[model samples]
Target: MAAMAPSPGRGAHKHGVIALILCLLVLQREAWGLLCYCEGLCPDHNNFNGTCEAKPNSFCFSAVETVYDVETDQWKEERTYGCLGPDELGLMQCRAYLTKHQRPKNISCCNESDRCNEHLLPQIIHHKPSVAPQGNFLESLLLVTLPLGFVALLAVIMTVWFRYRQRESSMLEYNKPLGLVIGPNDTLSDLIEQSSGSGSGLPLLVQRTIAKQIQLVQSVGKGRYGEVWLGRWRGEKVAVKIFFTTDEASWVRETEIYQTVLLRHENILGFIAADIKGTGSLTQMLLITDYHQLGSLYDYLQNTTLNYFSMIRLSLSTSCGISHLHTEIFGTKGKPAIAHRDIKSKNILVKRNGECCIADFGLAVKYVSENNELDFGNNRKVGTRRYMAPEVLNETINMSCFESLKMADMYSFGLVLWEIVRRCASESGDRYLLADEYQLPYFDCVPPDPSFEDMHEVVCVRGVRPDIPLRWHYNEVLKTMSKVIQECWHANPAARLTALRVKKTLYKFHVSDGTKIV
Candidate 1:
């Protein structure tokens, strides 16, 4: 019927073949059921694509683990999926194994699926807080380096400034003319120019240093301003005119006149230096100048007599001094014409060479023609009473006329000549005679220290002058001196002899007397 009563062998073979198909189907289902996804990040067990081939008797597993990164010094979470045995399927097993061996932060879950481990395990989602650096590397470097850089820059600047100042100081010291370079032939004017670049005077510091080194030896003279002292500087004698602080104006006036350009001359006292020294209330104002041991004409006349030659030298030298004072040089460096308002024997110094120089310029006045300026100095009446000319005694002189001042000086010069001639004894041609005792012009008419009133009465009111001795007429030199004196002391100032004329007349006499005047 369906298989012709089915042969027993064929039937058995057909049954056996059906059993083999069923067994193959069952075996394929068991093989597929046992398969796991086996994808993991493990380098040792995974392939190059971070996945493993499906394995038997294993399950899909997910693990949330932590590992210490030694280089980063931080805790990191590492996730992996791979086949796990039945014993590893429990959370505690994986957790304990990972915690002990792999240092896992948390255990895993297992599932049997194709890609059950594809998604990460759900956890508390603990995120590693990002660590922020304290400061930028560049900023930290600048903070440390910037201040040191500034300090180094400041040190360099200070060193440069210090060197510049040192160089400037060295130049200044080198420019100063020390006394060692000065020669015997060098004049003070030359020294002033060499030291100051302009012939202005000594530098202020040089003046102070010189003043400080001076040693006062003795008081030489006294005046209304203050005392005159003989001082020594490096064994060189110098006259120190010291004024009381109260009379500082007089000292300043004198110094100013002395410093006039082109004012240095043999007939003018040589200015050395001027300074103010000491501390506070003890300060002393000093004017330093060349000193002469012979003292003033007044002192010399009072102590020593003179011969005819000495007499002529004194009169002519005084005339030369006054004439030079009246001269106004015209050039780049010029001197204004000056008048010695207080000309007297005491204000004239006698040099060792028998010459004279005008001194005591406190009451002097300068006349500048270009500006028509007349400095009528201090108002104080300051001439020796006995030496006042007629115009001066009567206060009737023309103040504006420069010639009137010259005339007044001439009148005083006449009196000085009289004083010089009275002490002279002619020694020419074996005519040896002792000279008369030195006396002031009006010594007979007034007291030794005559008052202004006494002088005014004798000179202006009475029109009296020193009498020329009748004996002078006997000698030619005395007679000529007497004539010059008469012309100089005329009551009318205009009629007075000029200083130049007086000097010329004395020079002529020196020639006529068989003497060659130098």
Candidate 2:
């Protein structure tokens, strides 16, 4: 996208917006429905100045995009004005949106009164190569440019300061990953059902509108792809993952996967928005999701030990989530099977309900049955060192086969299960037993932050696995769990149990042992 100069009409637009907002606040809400002014790219092009009534809960939207006219060598805006469909989540989903450049793109939504979205909101565009037209006066610049520049400058400084300090889980040390659309009487799920939702996630337009509305609360954690921060929008806390510009591919891939048809599940990270913001060299690529309290499964296990029942819930919920990812739907709106290549404890988050959901899709692969294609999500598939499967460590993985990747995930899941179970406190008939200190898989065999060579030597060459305590055998449920873990991390990838099989095995314990999966 080429950066260009500021649009000349920007000054007039701001005055129009202030007046527009004031008018919207005073106008009475239409009793029947919203009546929006339809113009430009209206459904009935002939009736450009027509007005249309919006359906219940729907809002008014208007958009303008400056398109380059190749033949004329000039930028011309394509306008869209009408009653837009209901946003996937709720009426509150509507937000102000704009893209910077000489050729700017602007879209806005309003529901305060009839014809509330007649004009797009004012936006400051940066990195324009040319100057504003001579006709735009000094007074116009003073009134519009000065105050907007001050606010923008202050915001940029704060964002940079918070971002510069972003690294690891020290900031959100007490936080956890809260599920977006789950728990008792989840209102967000009902919002999705009531709206004209695709049952996937928020639409791209809605997501982009939301991107600028978020205010970073604090740095949550950092990783290879980017740093994550807790952010707030309209009093609701959300997770904002700001990726390095070089990791742009990962951001796009995760966004695409999250927007997959019918992909919204209780056990997967809840995606809210994906956006690229800022100007020129200072651009930021961001992926926003719902914020849960505890940072990650690894962080949670380290800070808080769990009871046996909580341990089982985490294990079972995780397997169920993975199973949904692995299984492909067949309908027209079906989703292809996805394999989460990096499935370590750090990538799994524990919700307040004592269940785990999978996160991090930068290295995920999707299998499309229609064309028998494998999408590696445009990343150089790099498995985590500590949770590397035997085949992955030895470089024997069949990248061509989708099942090969799924099997590798099982191996990582086994390591995560071990992490969770190690913190579980259980009781035998005759004795009370508490688990040992939380540790990563192969903590004893390899040094901290193991290299590829170190993991290869420890896992593939030595044929080693995480040890199970003899005390685990005393408890019937723990004994069964230990067996399942063994099968998942088998030396042979094909020999490893499928995700569904693992979920079934854990589900059996849930039913017989009087423990709940939720």
Candidate 3:
């Protein structure tokens, strides 16, 4: 059939009709394709060869389009399209198509021009779901640990606080008054009452049968052991010497020595009676002796001055007292001789008749036995250092020996004489007058000598020498006294003069006729 030309109106209508029919055919074909594609590529299936495959649990459905380069043979992504239903297998297929064209199958694509082949498709992978742990696990652990840590911290703080409070309480208890009683039933008010009741009254003496008869008037003096009191015994005023409980041993020893010797002389301090009662807390022992109202030689000299005549009397009295101890009696077994270990001024007791007596033979020891001599051992450094002889300072000399005791006593007596002279000079204002005139006074009158840096060097090597003034009142008397002191202070024991010689020399100075001045 040959083609025939139609009129213009007819041609236009016919063209319009043909166009409408073409549009309707395209629409129908598209609808049918869409329905088939949706069914085949459901989420549960893989869209291949017009069949569905089982989908994974984590799959999603979508459509994708891609284009392929003719020369390179590589697919490239164009556009993405989405489906409305859950079709996991179809989604994977779409992802594979997109991957093949550089656009994932899980993503939608645009048109047919972007279509790609199966060889370039990417494999779709399934992943397991991640599980988060239970929310309360860490919270529960923290809740358990935090409270325990806080409790431990609180316990430590409380322990420290308790200890500090306890220590403070103990300190307060210690500082409380001694009278405060500590007992289970005692209260703070009770303690206060007890403390208030204890006043500053004299402590009551523990009475014994012997002390009961001897009535103590008042305390005269106190010593390391106990107090000495002025007491009356059978209408006679006597000094009752009491010993402390702590010094009971010393008291026993002294009693033994006194009983053994049975020392009885006008110069020697007489022991009247010992307490018949044995040891007790307060009245351990008591020794009765005749009391001298003049007190100690030191006190008498300090209080009153002696004229030249009285000084002579005092010297004669003191010499006679010391000589009696050293003198041996005709009837005695070995030797009735004794040595006063301590010969200071205070030990010399002044009597009412200006007579002197030797007292305090506490440190005295008998020189008759070899055992007595050895009792001192290597201990030569006994007695007061100020009155100690130079030979006594030397360790080689044994002080327990009679010869050594005599020498030590001589040295002490020399110091005593010096003390008496110094006191007399001071009372007469001679020391100050001499000091002003000649710029010289007795060595002891000056301030104490400066302390030597090396004490051993000074004591052992450089011996002490007293500085006596040149312009003294009686130059002859001063020279004699200095010579006597020097002889007694000799470094060698053998060189030192004896106590008998010292007594004789002093006697010659002032003693004349039967009468004396003390």
Candidate 4:
């Protein structure tokens, strides 16, 4: 049919409808756009402040954060205001992940009006001079005198406390025995059994005695929690991990984990004592253990190359330590299964007998099978970015399942194995030139210090991993090791090998004169 030409009135009505539709479209666009105030503190000390035009259905947000300043060794508060889209919580978590040292204190969102976030948070004012109060001479005199009296009283109390503490410490040091020796010919195992009788730690008196006699030599290491010192106790060297006052919780946690009944395995770091020592307002949290002169595996690998036998022994010993940690013992003095949340080469120490012992239990969690309970500790989520598992990087880990935690540990253990293999030399002493640098996992794909976003992008989004050298396929043992590493870090968390499985695989591969198992 032929299209009909509209009459004047009909055409006018059609044009009016078209104009109305166009007007509604413009109004809709205006409704979708909203202005919000934006400001932030960046890592480079740059100021970010401006008005942001929010996207469709977005909201304005105000956030306060606490960041640790490496240069000053202090925590600084940061305030930020900005527009956040539908994925608000996820975006905030990503930001937290990117900044390992920066943690969110408060984050609030509002969608009430344009510029709703303006002045939502207080700005940090630096170095504002205090104005002197207007007062007569007599009033100022009274204020000064009262404060002076208070200070004098405080000084007297402090002097008395100091003298008392000095006298007590001297007396205690004189009377206390130097060390707790089960017998003159007793082994470490015998000592451990005697000290911890169906309990997690040594007797309180024993801990105090050990702390009183140790003489600190020098600082051997420093970490986020505090410093580690080399000390001499009863003419024998010991490692003293001294926690800062702020890290009291971590000190307590590590001590509890280390003193787990039946946790004293040869491949695990030996716990000697835990004590709180000091005077007045300043007290030191001390964790005493056996000293390993070779230091951490990371430090040792940097300086020395490992032969095949040494590599297998180190790998097996580490696996054994982790397996024992995961194994739950049964009995009255039984130990619960444990998961080492932050497993890495640096946390593994090399002992004098050329074996590896797992150290640093600050982030460990214990699972009690009897009550079907898991103690998810209150420690901060801190793992080496390069060694994080896919589930952890993506924040999809099942926290309720104890097995999930063990699987994550296995993933990290696999990465540690990769590190060991990179430094391995042939039994015939043939060094692989390309793999000699002792590179960390994903070193080639990410930055020297990969941020959370960088790792998330590579590991979660793109699924990139450390490149396996094609040359490794030529050697049978190296090829087998590569296969094991690949299986350990499978993208699917459920597909990874257990610590026991890894230990058994390495044990079967070993052809050297080492202990049969951990």
TM-score of each model, in listed order: 0.61, 0.62, 0.48, 0.62
Candidate 4: stretches off by over 4 Å: 1-201, 427-435, 513-518
What order do candidates take by lDDT, descending? 4, 2, 1, 3
- Per-residue CA lDDT of model 1 for 439-514, tens digit only, reads 7888889998988899999988888889887668777888899999999999998888898899888887543334
Model 1 segments more than 4 A misplaced: 1-205, 377-379, 427-431, 511-518
lDDT of 3 at 293: 78
- Candidates 3 and 4 compared by lDDT, better number: 4
- What digit string (tens of lDDT, one per residue) describes model 4 on residues 1-518? 99988699988999999999989866674677667777662222344447666666667778777667899976777777777765454364213354556555677777667788876764443321122123345688988999999999999999999999998887466336434454555544456566535545555566677788889999999987889999987578889999989888788889889877888888999888899988888899999998999999999988877766787888889999999999999987788999999999999999988899999888889999899898866776577788899999999998778899999999999999989888876432354434467878887788898999999999999988788876667767778889999999999988999999989998897466542211
Q: Model 2 — TM-score against the truth?
A: 0.62
Error of 1 at 402 (Å): 1.7
lDDT of 1: 0.75
Error of 2 at 326 (Å): 0.5
**Residue 477, candidate 4: C-alpha displacement in angstroms:** 1.1
Q: Which scores greater on TM-score, model 1 or model 4?
A: 4
Q: What lDDT does the true structure give each of the candidates?
A: 0.75, 0.78, 0.53, 0.80
> lDDT tens string, model 3, 252-291?
5455434434255566665545554554543456765668
Q: What is the Å distance of residue 9 in model 2 from its true position?
A: 82
Top lDDT prediction, candidate number: 4
Q: What is the alpha-carbon lDDT of model 3 when measured against the actual structure?
A: 0.53
